[model samples]
Target: LEGADGPGLFNAAQTLRQLVTRESSKGKGSKGDKGSRGFAGVTVRDWPASPVRGITEGFYGDAWSQQERLEQLDFLGRTKQNRYLYASTDDPYRQSSHWRDPYPAAQRAEFRALAERARRNHVTLGWAVSPGQGLCFSSDEDRRALLRKVDAMRALGFGAFQLRFEDVSYSEWHCDEDARTYGSGPKAAARAQAELANAVARHLSARHPGTEPLSVMPTEFYQDGATDYRSALAEKLEQGVQIAWSGVGVVPRTITGGELADARSAFRQHPLVTMDDYPVNDYAQDRIFLGPYRGREPAVASGSAALLSNAMRQPTASRVPLFTAADYAWNPKRYDPEASWEAAIDAVAAGSGTEEAREGAREAVHALAGNDASSLLGGRESAYLRPLLAEFWAAYDAADSDKKSEVKRLRRAADQLLDAFGTMRTARERVPDALEREVRPWLRELARRGEAGEQAVKMLTAQARGDGGAAWDARLALKQLRADGPERGAVVGKGVLADFEKRALETSERWAGVRRKAFGDQTVHGGPTARPDSPAEAAVDGDPDTAYRA
Candidate 1:
């Protein structure tokens, strides 16, 4: 325990399973209705220490079997997780335009029957109906086709629907595919997206009356370009359409907290809905590289909190729904990522922590490191080697050529790590932490380099884009003041060449100097500072604004 790395934590979990489950089995517990072991008076402080709980549903539209759904639901209910947002598109009940094709009218009745079955299990089936051609208006026929699907959902007891436009049209074309095919711009796409959402909402409101409200995934417009989406469909968004916020290629676009809040405020006034979409990124949008089955390694797979926090930092006018890519297409809000991972692990464990259980723990720990490595590295530079290459873009835009060359080298390293990850993913033995210790320092170095690289790229990108160096520099300085990661401290502690870099580094060092002695001795080499002193408890708390102004 004293010398644990990612693999160590994983092995510890494995050993803990043996200790906990074997101990659990030795005692004969109260018999259940079916003679299954049952616990009596189990007191649990069960809750995610974080606010963002992820919903994961089945993959490839496959039914998760009713047993799987129930198991996940039970754990989530215990965890107080409020959102169930990922239902697979291939769900048996999912209705496309040609409903008659999948099943005859009589068999379709059975699909409707499953809707109640879903609700009875404390799950709401979010209907996924394609409203129009990619971000554009569909023919009157297709529109009616979609409406019919919505009508069926109401009859079956669905409360919400997301006009999922991501897969329907031009990959990154303006909002609507149908419209884009007809040569439309952002405004046209927005109008179509907004109109379709409103039509569905009106139908649901009238047909079901107190059913859940309606929402849609605004086109991929927010994915790139155009700061103010208003020009495209601000009016439609204002009119009550929901916009889906997703940062597809890289980190979230640098829009400030205030700007996002203001946009949400304006849209809410129009009776509009605003929601963000977060697809777990370690793989391509369509596929997730989970271990053995299509399941992901545990750590990278359990990214529900990170997604939730991305939304939480914004205005909560409405609870924004986050869905897995496919589930978002199926009923949008029925999958739970955390529950999914736990279920997968439990299934693999099979109610016991044998050798297989240890292997599962090992995989889970690997995920934790991979997911946390990006943040730990500060940016991309230090973490570009093979397994970590997914984080490569974080370093690619370096202003200095030498730094850029280093990024390429790191990417090659990441490739090797990924090869090992693939082997470890299927390995049966519980591997030791030392097996991967060779890359620990490299990962740390990446974090150090990433911090400096981020600052440099921020400045150069701004200048290249002609945003005026001084204003961007000033904004950059302020950002550094509030930023808290390994890279910032390292750059500041060691010093970087650019004056702004030097200044940011100085401020970082000074803050650390005061906060270190105040909070506790600094522990930079291993990881984030490990002390219990809150910001309010620190000496700097005496003058909050001034302390932040540093």
Candidate 2:
């Protein structure tokens, strides 16, 4: 505490709180317990690797409520995050067509209160405006309108502002005035954006006096390599303005040091802040990614000025991944995804302060993680299912006698998973409401899919025993359980049941010939055979060359 400032002191306090909670969970150092009375010899000397480590609510879905934003600020403070970007595409005045309008009385009050809350939490409320959608950039009136909007927010106590030109059409001018003044090309657009940003930065500096550097997100923020527009923007944009880059692609699978270095070179050494688009599951509403933060090289921190995670619409659900992101930004070199994730789970679960609540929260995290489909970072599934899948797969690939035991084990695992889902559905008071709301649908789907998998196992076993009636019943049940694609509420584990049904049918049909022979003279209807020159079968068999030759 001697050398630590506000954030450093806050982080130290959080670490100590976590240490006490952990020890308490282990039944040590409690009121009635016999244990050491002093601190656990743990010392944390922590500081952020990047100057700006935070979350940006710059998504395209439903905006988080003011209460949610306030709660998120508290969570960010607890996790040691120091910045919050209040840019949601759904907000018309903030982005979209109504860029020049001021917030109404009620909304302005909300902003003032939010700014106050942010101050209490030591978080910088970075206000952002997006006028590039239809701004006549060359018009004096248009420039004044943009400045007026920033001025209003500055009055509400926001010391940071971002001019967002991202996702806007900069290939051509918005009006005849811009076209006549700067011509219709990338350089013209870059010049217009640069001038507007420079003006805003200068105005903020002169008026606000100790404001943080201005931030901007250009239209071509994500790139495989630099373009004329990027180069021009880099050269023309004011040196004090920080540029936001989204790695190689808009939603890249990985971000490496090479990509960052290339982007830095493209931007002519201007301050680059990474606008990471992970754990933001808006694009694929069928997924709620509960995976630990991964795919960002440690060198990314040193290569950029700051790192900001783009958050999902569900603020509570986003905590698990954001927690890992906070750790990475604090100390990228020694960041461990698994350790951070486990700690996050513990922190979230222990928030309710009971063993039962902790157990329920852990279960919810597992269920949600099971539904994640991120290819870059792996996700967690129900504890029972993880081992069950392994056992089932191992037995499946083994001899026939081993199959029965594995099948029974798989069925038990499925039953246990269903039971867990049932417990979560009913344990309203034991689990967090947000966690339950976000994870319940997936849990129900998982239960249905588990039933389908159990039926498939039974169908396979019945076919092997020549019991056509039982196999037929199981197959019919499996077909009925097949998912009819993803419904709107079906965000997590979408299409999982359908995939299981398809695989089950394929396995069942593979043994049709033997089943027909077993029940001789019964006129059994075997499924359709592979067509003589069918591409589907050829691809499955890896015989494209042979099929073409034939």
Candidate 3:
């Protein structure tokens, strides 16, 4: 800590804070504890692997409230993140639609407060402007408008600036002025963007001396190899201006050292920074991803100047992954995703300051983490359900006497899971209100599904034993309960229930056919399918007649 400066010093302070939190939580000086009274013999020397490690509120959703943003700044400080980019798509002024508009009095005040908070937390607040949508790269008026916006934000105390030309078409100039000035082509587009970025950097320096170099996110920010536009941009852009890249794809599954090297080469090594889109569940709003920040190799830290995660819309849930991102950015060489995930859970639980609260928070987060619809069968929820499913299926496929035991076991497992959900629902005081609000509906639906799943298992058992009446009763009960359909406003667990319903119905139908064959010359009352008046019933049975009616 003695020699560290800038981000390094911030990282050291965070490490010390973590160490203290860990030690105190161990009851080091408590009356009943017999541990050491002083420090727990912990020694720490730490620095970030990347120079700039932070997050970008750059998702497409309702922007985080001012209070949420303030909390996020504090969270960033706690995790040793040294940078924060304010580039939410929800903000019109931040992007092209209203690029020239100044923040209103109240919004400006919020920005001022945010900037002060960021300064206090030792985080560099970077404001990004996206004017590429309607900009005339050749007009003085456009240039002035762009610089004026930056000047306004600079007056509010944001020293770092980024010009984002992403997601906009550059096939032809938007304005006739630019079309006349620079012909329509990739080279022209790159030249225009690079020149404008250089101009912004120089303007900021001249107006606000000692400001950090400007950052730029190009239109073609992701590529496996260099292109003509990239080469033109590299040739035209200033060396002091940093550039942001989002790997080979916008949301790449992986970022390797070779990709970083390619990006460096493509950008002519203009202090490259990674704008990672992982763990940002905005695109997949139906669920929240609580998994570790992964896919980027450790070597990426050394190859890039910095790594900044683009967070999910749910700020509280995003913390689970951001914590791991911080750990990886701080020490990628020895980073372990699983270890980091455990540490993240502990860190979140530590905030509660009570053993019961910690356990409750951990369980709640663990359940919510499985809400990632993208990896439905691969998360914590699936892990919990998979074993029970295997047991139920094994027992069903076993001897006749074993079916009853297996069915009972499956019902018990379902009840236990439902009970866990009940505990999570009732532990609202223990978990963060934000997280509780974000995940409550999903949990409710999960409990309901557990109930329905147990019932479905029972129905299957009855059908396997040729008890049509029992099977019919169980099916009718499940339909009446409306447990097979997803809960209203629930983003996760839709696929989970849908898959279960499909498999259960298929298995039930197959068993019914086997029963009919065994009885011989029998008539099937429902003729392979039954339609109920209730929409939920239709939903469960996959009845086309009422499937889309609701």
Candidate 4:
């Protein structure tokens, strides 16, 4: 655990934790100090592919709680992510309106404590200040005000700083000084912004020597080719000051090596880093992307000076994808997104002691994550349920000569689908409470989706077995559930599961529309009658994860 810096030990500790599993917390109030590992007589020495592999809390909407920030810093350390940029766009002290002011005493205290936690986790704490909206780039007062803000932030243990111009207007200037000093248009805005960044970089170099190089998020952050703005920034911005680009769009689906090279070439050799905006759902606040990082070439990691993910509002739930992003950032060449995603799911779900079979939290988390495993980056939602639904449909659609045998086959398919829905129904109850809050809506939708599916399956199966009363009731319940199923923002199982239910409903309706007269008032048979205390319907119910009198 030796290095020129003190963080090496923290990293080594993280590595060691990965090598062992805690085995002792099976009992109530147990210390859980006991652990075991398969690896023996081994030493691991490692380094991340990218230098700044961490998060930028740079999303829109609500800022994270103080506890969330602290937890995020710890997560970064655990994953060997060495930097954490504090830049929640909604945080008053972080943006244009309040960039000149200091944090309140309470927030300042929180920042100091965050810094200490970051230090313990081997994370470099950085703060981003967006002053472009109100800054007169040419004004002496604005320049010093920005610097004073930086100094104040530094005093609270921010080791690095980023200047954000991503949200500012290109045609407008904050003061008359900006139009007078730099002239007008995109090129002028670029030139002015570059000079301001240069001032801050030089100031940091002189006063805070050896701290991380200053970074700037350009107004033309994700643009292609060499524009007037790019050219001006290329020529004027200090070389050591990092340029942050968010791929080719605010949240692009793909970022290739060639595209990155092109963007770097456009910027003309300033140190370039990617502030990849995956898993950040600020624009679409209804979702959380739990998929593994994808569509990035290996060189995207090796080529960048650093790679930072913009995190979601939900800190704990954000770990699912952020973990994969960190894994890719550390070693992109060997990354397998699916495998990494599964491991990440395990790592996160394991925290809530969700290790049981069937309705356990692990499967529940998988359902929750798999159903939400999509974002701007592009992934299949309901990945876990898709195959199960397919299997059910395959069996349901199979052509069978024997009626009873076919009913048996269809029932088997329906049962598997129902079991999966069971997991989805109870997903929220299984995870940690904090994580539950962030994902409660999704979990609720998942449960609703599952319940709707179960009703559809039951309705179809009941009709198949010539049970008139049961089939009618199940269909009625299913219709009502479907009516209630239109969630405002949160979606689970996406379209496919709904399609399956829709098809089932249509097939049942179709059968009803073309039914024979049942050969002169014959009685229809159904499943076993229910006892009063435990209704037969309890078996198909969403919760308790158990069948009635099975």
Which candidate should be chosen as best, given lDDT against the real structure?
4
Q: Estimate each model's TM-score.
A: 0.42, 0.82, 0.82, 0.88
Candidates 2 and 4: which is better by TM-score? 4
TM-score of 4: 0.88
lDDT of 4 by residue, 1-550 (tens): 5444567666777767776543222332336533333445566767767767888888888889888888888888888899898887788777777878878999899999999999888888988888888788988988999888888888889998898888777789888877888888888888988999999999999988957999988989998888988888888997898899989988899999999899888999788879988888888877778999999999899999889998888888999999999999988988899988987776776666423532265677788888888777888888777777787777767725367777677878888888888777778888667778888888888888878888887877776666757777787788898888557788766667788788887676444532212336552221344343442334333321122122
RMSD to native, candidate 3: 6.4
How displaced is residue 63 in candidate 1, in Å?
A: 8.2
Tens digits of per-residue lDDT for model 1 on 1-550? Answer: 3213442343334435434544454453436433233344333222222222334342332344444444444433322343344345554344333431333576446545545544444444455554333222555655665677667656655555656654444323423445444455555556666666777777766777766556555555244434334445556543444454433322342333343444444344332222222223222221112211112122211321222212111111001112122222222234454443333333333432454555554453343232222221032211213323324334323323347665565444435444443433333233233222312332343333334444433443333333444424644554563354442212211222133345533433343333333336532211144233533234343432232223
- Model 3 C-alpha lDDT versus the unseen true structure: 0.74
lDDT of 3 by residue, 1-550 (tens): 6535665666677777777666766774479776543455666666667878899999888889999899999999988887899998898887778989998999999999999999988888889888888788898998999989889998897878888888767676787778888787888889999999989988988988867788889888887678888889989998888888989888887889988888888888888889998677676676667778777888788677768999888887788889989989989989997788777877665556556667777766655554342432133445545555666666566635456775566455545644543543444445666776766666666556655665676677677666767776777666665634567766554455446656766676555432122236543233334345533334443342232232
Q: Indicate the residue-level lDDT of 457 in model 2.
A: 65
Looking at model 3, which ten-residue stretch has the lowest summed lDDT?
A: 541-550
Regions more than 4 Å wrong, model 3: 1-3, 23-39, 349-354, 373-381, 391-430, 453-477, 481-484, 493-550
Q: Flag clash pairs in model 2.
A: 286-491
- Evaluate all candidate structures by whole-model CA lDDT and list the values in order: 0.38, 0.73, 0.74, 0.79
* Clashing residue pairs, backbone N/CA/C < 3 A, model 4: none
Model 2 scores a C-alpha lDDT of 0.73
Q: Look at candidate 1 and tell me the lDDT of residue 391.
A: 40
Model 2 residue runs over 4 Å out of place are 28-39, 373-387, 396-431, 438-440, 450-480, 483-550
